[model samples]
Target: MNIDECESSPCQNDGTCLDKMNAYQCLCHKGVEGAMCEINRNECLSSPCKNNATCIDGYDHFSCVCLPGWEGELCDVNIDECFSHPCQNDATCVDGIDSHRCVCQPGVSGINCQQD
Candidate 1:
């Protein structure tokens, strides 16, 4: 097949089978984690953390858990600096917890609707 076809092959989310070199490589996705990328890494499978902790995905590894008002694959979900609360005086909302921003009204300020 072609490279595009190989890249889009249904070799599983974590495993990748390349036909060029007559071989395959495992490029694990965010959640799934393993040496060969064969094993489905269940972030919530093990009770590693205490309390109703949440598992967060990481670059190479994962975090233990997250604190209150926090979320993410690796508890990296920080407080949205531009949440709704940041808006003022009928201002519109702007950036959210993640990397999202909102449109502002005519008399709004800041990256989003901060002031008017």
Candidate 2:
């Protein structure tokens, strides 16, 4: 009835309360939705990421930051670091997390097997 009801800030979490005819309406912030703005919306409820990536909730949405050895919008693609053939001296190139490993042959050594 009176605006004083909303003045007391019945809404929680910094919600804005609008006084109505004998009642009040709470305008909740992002990620919060309810009659009294007490419910927290799960941003990751729909599993927005692919390839088992982690989802971090944002203000009104979410972010899918891909992990190592993975890339793309949903982390569905595996990065091939050995595409350029970084290994030398007949070494084997193995793809790794944001990198590559050169498995040296019988007589080769060093990172890319460049040294004998």
For each candidate in turn, the TM-score is 0.28, 0.61
Candidate 1: where are CA atoms >4 Å away? 1-8, 14-18, 33-38, 52-116
Task: Indicate the worst ten consecutive residues by lDDT in candidate 1.
Answer: 1-10
lDDT of 2 by residue, 9-75 (tens): 8897778999887788999998888888887787888998887799987656787888887888778
Task: lDDT for model 1, please.
Answer: 0.55
Candidate 1, residues 1-116, lDDT tens digits: the string is 43444555545654655455545565667666554555556555565554456655444455666666456554555656565365555654555444545466676666545556
Candidate 1, residue 68: the lDDT equals 61
Model 2, which residues run further than 4 Å from truth? 1-3, 58-61, 65-67, 83-85, 89-116
Residue 111 error, candidate 1, Å: 51
What C-alpha RMSD separates each model from the true structure? 13.9, 4.4
Q: How much lDDT does candidate 2 score?
A: 0.86
True lDDT of residue 85, candidate 1: 63
